[model samples]
Target: MKQRLSLIIGIFIVMALSNAIVPVLPEYASEMPALQGIIFSAYFFGAFVMVIPAGVLGDRYGRAPFITAGLLLTLLSGGIILLAANPYAITFARIVEGIGAGLFVSCALSWVNMQPDHTRLSGLYFAGLNAGLIAGLMGTGILNSHFGQNSGVMLFTGLAVIPLLLSFFIRDTTGVLTNVLPPVHAIGWRNKWLYFSSFILVGISGVLVSLYPEFTDESPFILGLLFAAMNGATICASLIAPNISLQPIQTIRLASALVGIAVLLSFIAPAYGGIGGVFVLFMVIGGSIGFVFVSQMNYLAVSEKLQGTAIGLLTAASYGGMAMLPFFSGLLTEVFSYGAAFLVNGILCLLVTVTIARCRCALPE
Candidate 1:
C-alpha cells in the first residue's frame, strides 16, 4: 500500500486555504455585496479552468508534479493575498489559489481512485477535505477576531508548507503515460447527468457559505461555528457512507433528496426554528453533500487509461457548480428575497433527483 499520509495532508491544507476567507467575506469586501460574490466565486472559476487541463496533462506527463506545483501555487497565492493592497489583488490571489486547488484535487483524487482499498481511502480523503473546511471556517473566524482580516489567510498559508513538503513524497499511481486524449464520450459525455448531479448536489453547500456572512448579523466566531457544524456533519457522513451497503446510485439519490428538503427548510429555520434550527439544517445540507461526493466518486470509476480525465471532468463539474451557482444565487438574492433564492435552489435539487432517476445509461454496475 502507498503511504497516503502525504496526500491527506496535502489535500487538507489546500481545502483549508481555499476557504480561509469565508467567515470574513463581508468585512473583506466591505460594503460591496457584489464584490463579495465575485471574490468568492473567483477561486472556483480558477479551479474550473485548471482542472480539466490538469487532468488531461496529468495523464500524459504525471500526477505527482501537478500536485507539487499546486502546493507551490497555493503558497504563492497566500503571499499575494497577505500583501494585497486592494480587493482586486485579493481576488487575483484567490484565483491563483483556486488554480492550485483544482490541480491538486483532480490529480490527488485520480491518484486515490487508483490505489488498492480505494473505497476506504476515498472516505478518508473526503473526511480530511471536510475537516480542513471546518478548520478554515472556525480557525479563521477566531483568528480574525484576535488579529485582522488577513490573519486566517496568513495562518493557512503558513500551514500550507507541511503539505507542499509532503506532496513531494507521493509516488505516481498511474504507471504508464499515453499521449492519446481520454475518451470524453465514454468518461464524460455519456455520464453528463451524473456530472450534473455533482454540479447541483455539492453546489448547495457552496451557495450557503458564499451568502451566509451577509445573510446574518452573527459575529465571525459564531458564523464560523455555524459553518463548521455543517462541515463537521459532512466529515462524519463521508467516513460512514462508504461502510453502508447501499449502491452508489442509491446513496446519491437519497442524499440529493435530503439536500433538496433541507434547502427548502432552511428558509423557515431562521424564523421559526431559530438559530438551533438553522444549525440543524446546515448539518443536513452538509451531510448530504458529503454523501453525494463519496457516492459520486465511487460510482464514477473508470479504467486506468481514463481515470485522470474522468476524475478531472467530475471535479471540473463540481467546481463549476460551486463557482456558478453561488454567483447566480447571489444575483437572485439581489433581485428577490433570500427565501425565493432558497426555493429555487431547493427545486433544482429535486430536479436533479428526477434527472438521476431518469438516467438509464452509463450507470455503475
Candidate 2:
C-alpha cells in the first residue's frame, strides 16, 4: 500500500509540476512564436531519449534507485525553471525535468504491470496522472492570475519535495530472473502496434495541450479551466474504461476514431458553439484519449518478461509523438491557421487508425 501510494504521489507531482507552465506558454514566450514549439517539446525530447534506457536498466538493476533519482532530478529541474534567465534556459530545464519524469513513469509502470491486478491498478495510476494534470492546469492558471507569474512555479516546486521524500520509504522488488529477456529491439518490434497506437493517441492530446494557450483568446484562468475540463474527463474515463466489456483492440479503434472526430469538430466549436461547445468537445477528446491509453497499457501488460522493455518503448513512442507532432503542428500554425494545423492533427489520427487496422499483428487479449 505504501508503495502504491508513493507511486501515485510521485506520478502526480511529476505530472503537475511539468504541466503547470502549459497554460501560461503564450505569456511565457510571447515574442518567440517559432521557438514556442521547441520550448513545449523540449521535455518530451528529453523524456523520449531516457525512458527506454531507464526501463532496460531497471529490469536488470533495481527500479527503486531510478525512481529516487528521478524525483531528485524533478526537484532540481523545478528550481532551474524558477530561476531560468531566458527562454533557452527554461527549455533546457524542461528537458531535464522530462528526463526525470520518463525514468519514474517507465519504471513505475513496469512495476505496476508485473502485479496481478495490473488492469485495475493501471486505471488508478492513470487517474492519478490526469488528476495531477488538471491540478497543474487549473492551479497554476489561478495562482498565476491572482498572485504572479512565479507563484504557481513556487507552489508546485515546493510540493515536489513530498514525493521525493516518500521515495525513501518505498520498497524495491528487484529479483534475479534466470529466464533471459528478449533483446530490446525484438521486444519493441513484437509490440509495434501497441507502441504506434499509443504514439498517435497520446500525441493528439499533446497537440491540443501544447498549442491551445496560443490558439484561444481566453484569459489564463479561463484557459486553465478549459484545459481542466479536458483532463477532468480523462480522469473519469480512465477509471471507467477498464470495466467496459470490449476487447483492448476494439476499445482502441473506437476511442481513436472518436478522438479524431472530436478534434476535427473543435475547429468549429469556438466560432459556432461558443466556450461551452469547445468545452464539451475537449471533454470528448480527453475521454477518448483516456480510453485509448488504458487499452494500450492493458495490451502491453500481457508478458511479465517484456514488461519493462515494452512499457519503456511504449512511453518512448508516446513522448516522441508528443515532442514531434506538436512542434510540427506549431510550424503549421505559423504558416497556416490554427484550424488548419488542428485539421492536420485530426487527419493524422485517422491515418494511424487505418494503419493499425490493416496491420496483421494480433493484440494480446
Candidate 3:
C-alpha cells in the first residue's frame, strides 16, 4: 500500500509539473502569438520522441533508474524555464520537460501494471494524473496573476523536488520476471488498433488543453476554475472507473459518443449560455476521456509480457496526437474560428470512433 501510494503521488507530481504552465503559456507567448501552438507542442513533441525508447529500455533494465533520471531532467527543465528570456530557450526547455515526462510516465505506468491490483490502481493512477493537471492549472493561474510568471515557474520547480525525492523509493521490479520478454513487434495488431482509437480520444484532451484558454477572454482566475472543473470531473470519472461493468469496447463507444456531444455542445454553449454552458460541456468531455483512458490502460495490462511496450506505444500515440492535432487546430483557428475548429475536430473524432468500432467486429476474438 505504501508503494502504491508513493507511485500515485509520484505520477501526480509529474503530471502537475507537466501542466503547471498551461494556463499561463498563452500570455507567455503573447509577444509571438503566431507561434503559440508550436511552442505549446514542443513538450509533447519531446515526449513523442522519447517514449518508445524509454519503454524498450525500461523493460530491459528496470523502471526505477529511468523514473529517477526523468525527474532530474524535469527539474533541469524547470530551472531553464525559470531563467529563460527568449521563446527559443523556453521551447527548448519545454522539450526537455517532455522527454522527462515520457520517461517518467512510461516507466511509472509499467511499474503500476506489475502490481497485483492494477485495475483499481489504474483508476488511482489516472486520478492522480488529472488531479495534478488541476493543481498545475489552478495554482499557476492564481500564482501568476499575483506573483508573476517567474514565481509560478518557481512554484512548479519546487513541486518537482518532492517526486524526485520519492522516486528513489520506487522498487525496481525487473528482477521478478522469469522469462525474457519478446521484442516490440510482438505487440499484436489488435492492440495497435486499440492504441490508435485511444490516441484519437486523447487528442480531444490535447485540443482542450492547448486551445481552451483562447476560447474565452475571461480572467485567469475564471479560466483556472473552468479548467479545474474539467480536470475535477476527470478525477471523479477515474475514481468511478473501477466499478464500471461495461466491456472495453462498449465503454470506448460510449466515451466516444459523450466526447462528440461535448464538443458539439462546446461550440453551441458559448454562443447561447456563455461560459457556464461551455464549463458544463468541458466537464462532460473530461469525464468521458477519463473513462476512455482507464479502459485502454486496463486493456493493455492484460498482456504481462508486453505491458511495458504496449503502454509506451499508447503514451507515444497520445502525445503524438497532442503534438500534431492541436498545432493544426491552432492554424485552423487562425484561418477560421475556434468554433469551426472545434466542430471539425469533433466530427473527425466521431468518424474515427465509428470506424474503430467497425474494425473491432472483424478482429479475432
Candidate 4:
C-alpha cells in the first residue's frame, strides 16, 4: 500500500517535469524557433528512441529499473533547462527529460495495471498525469512572467526531484505481470489501416499541443493559466465520458470533430477579440484533448498483448505525430502566418474526422 502511494507520487512528479516546457517554450524560443520545435523533439526523440528498448527490457527483466533510471534522467533535463540559453542546451535538456518520461509512462502503467484494483489505479494514473501537466505549465508560466525564464526552468528542476524521492519505496512488486506470460495477438504489420486511422486523429490533438508554445508567447502568464483551464475541462470530460457510451472508434471520431471546430473558431474568427478567442480556443482544445488518448488507451488495454510493449507503441505513435507536426507547423508559420497555419491545420483535422468516421462504419466490431 505504501509502495503504491509512493509510486503515484513519482509518476505525478515525472509528468510535471516532463511538461515544464509547455509554458516556457516561448521564452526559451524567443528568437530560436528550432529550439521551440526541438522541445517537442527532445521529448519525442527520447520516447521514440527508447520505446522499443524499454518495452523489451520491461517485459524481459522488470519495469522498475527503467522507471528509476527515467526519473533521474528527468532531473538531469530539468537542471539543464533551468540554465538554458541556446537551442542546443534546451534540446539536450528535453532529451534527458524525454528519456525519463518515456521510461516512467511505459513501465509505470505496466506496473499499475497489475495491481489488485487495476481500473481504479488506472484512473488515478490518468488523474495524476493530467493534474501534473497543469501544474507544470501553469507554474512555469507564472514563474517566467514574474521572475524570468530561468526561474521557470528551475521550477521544473524542482519538480523533477520529487519523483526521485520515491526511489526508496519502489523496491519490488512481487512480479505481478511478467514476460514469461504468453503473448496475445497484435495488429501486426498488416494493421497499417488501424495505425493510419489512429495517426490522423492523434495529429488533430498533436497540432494543438504544438501550438501551445506560440500561444504562450502571446502571454506567458496566461499561457500556463490557459493550459490549466484546458486540462481542467479535459478531466471533467473524461469523468463523464463513460456515461456517454460510444465505442473507441466512435469516441475518437467525436473528439476529432470537436477539435476541428475549435481550431476553426480559434484560428479563423479569433472570436470575442484576441484574448477571449485564445481563451475559448484553450477551452475547446482542452475539452477534446483527452478523447483520443482515452479512446486509444481503451483499445490498447483490451486488444494488445504484452501490455507494456503495446502501450509503448501507442506512446510512440502519439508522440511521433506530435513531434513531427510542430516542425511542419513552424515551417508553415514561416511561410505565411500563424493564423494561416492554424486554418490549414484545422482543415487537415476536419478531413481526418471524416476519414475516421467513414472507416469506423467499414471496420468489423
Candidate 5:
C-alpha cells in the first residue's frame, strides 16, 4: 500500500510537470511559430524512440531504477526549459522530457499491473495522469499569466524535485530475470485493432494540444479553464471507468464514436455557441479518451508475463500517433483552417472505428 501510494504520487507529479508547459509553449516560441508543432511533438518523439527499450529493460531488470532515471531526466529537462533562449534549446528539452515520460510511464504501468484488482487500479492510475494534466494546464496558465513564462517555467521545474525524490523510494520488484523472450504471438501483435484505437485516441488529443490555443482569442486564464474542463472530465471518466463494464470492442466503438462526434462538434460549436460550445465538446472528447485509455490498459493487463511488452507496444503506438498526427494537423491548419483539420480527424476516427469493429469480428473471442 505504501508503495502504491508513492507510485501514484510520483506519477501524478511527473505528469503534472510534463503537461504544465503545454498551453504556454506556443507563447514561449512565438518568434518562430512554424516550429511550435515540432516543439510540441518533440516530447512524444523522444518517448516513441525509447519506450520499447525501456519496457524490455524494465521486464529484465527492475522498474525502480528506470523510474528514478526517468525522474532525473525530467528534472534535467525542466531546468533546460527554464534557461532555454531559443526554439532549438526548447525542442531539445522537450525531447528529454519525453524520454523521461516514456521511461516512467512504461515502468510505472508495468509495476501497477503487478498488483491485483486491476480494474480498479487501472482507474486509479489513469486518474493520476488526467489529474496531473488538469493541474498543469490550469496551474501553469495562472502562473504564466501572473509571473511571466520564465518564472512559470522555473516554478514548474522546481516542482519536479518532489517526484524525483519520491521515485527513489519506489520498491524494486524486478525478480528472476529471464533470458528467454516470449513468443511473438504472445505479445498480442495480432491485436491491431487495439493499437489502432489507441493511435486514433491520442492522435485526436495531440491535435487538440497543438491547435486548440488558436481557437479563441481568450485570456490565458480562460484558456486554462477550457483545458481544465476537458481534463476534469477526463479525470471523472477515468475514475468511473472500472464501474462501467463493457466488452473491449464495445468500449472501443463507443469511445471512437464519442471522439468523432466531438471533433465534428468542434467545427460547429464555436460557430454557434462560441467558446462555450467548444469547451463542452472538449469535455466530451476528454471523457471519451479516458474511457478508451483505461479500456486498453485493462486489456493489456491480462497477462502477468507479457503485460510489460504488451503495454510497451501500446505506448509506442499511442505516442507515435501523438508525435506525427499533430504535426500533420498543424500543416493542414497552415494550408487550410482549424476546421478543415478537425474535420479530417473526425473522418479518420469514423473510419478507424469501422475498421476496429471489423477486426473484432475476425479475431477470436
Candidate 6:
C-alpha cells in the first residue's frame, strides 16, 4: 500500500474501534441499569479531559509515535473490555479507549492533511476514516446480533489488531525528523470565531450520536448499523463534494439542509417506513459528518498556534457533547419524548446552516 494509505488504514482501525465501542456501552450497562449514562460517559469524560494535552504531545513528539502509543492503548483497552463484567471495570476500559481515540484522531488528521490533495489518493484518507467508523459500528452490531455482548468485546479486540499491524507499515513522515520546526510557543488561538464554530459543529454531531439510541429502543446493534450507514454516506459525500464548485461553507449549508430535512422526515416517519427510514436518517447523518469534518479542518489548517489546540479542542468538542448528551437528552425525553429530541437537534443544526450561509466566504479554490 502507499504510505499515506498505510497510515490511514492504521488510523481507520483506531477510528472504527472507538466508534463501535461507544454504542456498546448501553448494552453493557444493562447488567447495571442504574449506571448506563455514567458508564457511557466515562470514556468520553477521559477523552474530553485528555484531548488538548494529547494534541500538544502529538505535535511535539510526532504524530506517528503518539498514534502508535494510542493504538497500543486501544489494544489493551479492548482486551480489558473482553474480560470486564463489572460496571467499574468496563468504565475504566472505556476511558482507556477514549484516550486512545483522542490521541489517534488529532495526530492522524494532521499527518493525513500533509498528503497531496486534488488527487484520487487524497480522498482515500477521509474515506478510510469514515469507512473505518462505518465498518466498526456496522460490523459490531452484526456481530452482537450473532454473538451477544461478551463476544462483542472480543470482536473489537480482533479488529483493533489490524491498526496495530498497519502502524508498523507506516514509515515516519519527514516532518518527524525535520531540521526546520515552528517554535511551538509562537502559535496562538486568537481566531475565536473560526475555531469555536468548528468545535460547536463537532459537538452537535457527538450529541446526536450519543443520544441517538434513546430515539429508538430497537437494538444497541441498530445504533451501530445506523451509524455505519451514516458514515458510508459521509464517505460518498466527501468524494462528490469537491466536484461541485460550491464553497466549503456553501457545501456545509447545503449538507446541513439535507440533514435537517432528513431528520425531520425521519422523526415524522421514524418507524412508519421501517428500515428504509432508518437508512435515510443515517444518510443525512453521514452528510453532516462529511461537511463538518472537511469544512472545519479546512479552517483550522490555516491557523498556527491554534493548530494543536484546534485539533485538541476539535476532539474534545465531540467528547464534551458525548458527556452532556446522555443527561440532557435523557431529561428531554422524559419530559417531551424522543421525537422532540430529533426536532431540537434539527432546529439547532439548521440554525447553524443559516448562520454559515449568511457569513462565510465560499471555500477557496
lDDT of 3 by residue, 1-365 (tens): 55676568767777777777676667668867667656667888889988887877788777789988888898899899888887788899989999998898888888877776777898899999888888777777678779877666787688778778877777876433324664666564656666766677788777876677667667767777877888888899988987875456777777887888788778767778898888888899888888877777776665446556767888988887777777688889999998888888888678766766653422123
Query: Relative to the unseen true structure, what is the C-alpha lDDT of residue 342 in candidate 6, on a scale of 0 to 100?
Result: 70
RMSD of each: 2.3, 2.7, 3.0, 4.2, 2.9, 3.9
Top of the candidates by lDDT: 1
lDDT of 2 by residue, 1-365 (tens): 77787788888888988888776777668888767767777887888999998888778776788888888889899999889878889899899999999899988888877777778888889999989888777878779889998788789889888878877776655432324554989877766776787888888877887778777777766776787888889889989977874466667777778888889988788788998998998899888888877777777666446577778998999888877787788889999989889899888777766767653334444
Model 2 worst lDDT run, 10 consecutive residues: 173-182
Q: Which of candidates 5 and 6 is the stronger one according to lDDT?
A: 5
Regarding TM-score, does 4 or 5 come out ahead? 5
Candidate 4 TM-score over all chains jointly: 0.79
Best by TM-score: 1
Off by over 4 Å in 4: 1-7, 21-31, 80-90, 115-117, 144-149, 167-198, 209-218, 242-246, 271-278, 336-340, 354-365
What C-alpha lDDT does candidate 6 achieve relative to the native structure?
Answer: 0.64
Model 3: clashing residue pairs?
Answer: none
Please give, for residues 252-349, the per-residue lDDT of candidate 1 as tens digits: 67778889998898877776888898899899988888887777777655433566788889898888888778878988999987888899999999
lDDT of each: 0.82, 0.81, 0.77, 0.65, 0.77, 0.64
Model 6 pairs whose backbones collide: 187-305, 188-305, 247-363, 248-363
Model 3 TM-score relative to the real fold: 0.89
Instruction: Report lDDT (Cα) of residue 31, candidate 3.
Output: 67
Q: What TM-score fits each model? A: 0.92, 0.90, 0.89, 0.79, 0.89, 0.80
What candidate 3 gets wrong by more than 4 Å, as runs, is: 23-30, 174-182, 185-188, 336-339, 358-365
**Given candidate 1, what's the lDDT at residue 30?**
90
Identify the runs in model 5 with alpha carbons over 4 angstroms from their true place: 23-30, 172-177, 181-188, 215-219, 358-365
Find the 10 residues in a row with the least total lDDT in model 3. 356-365
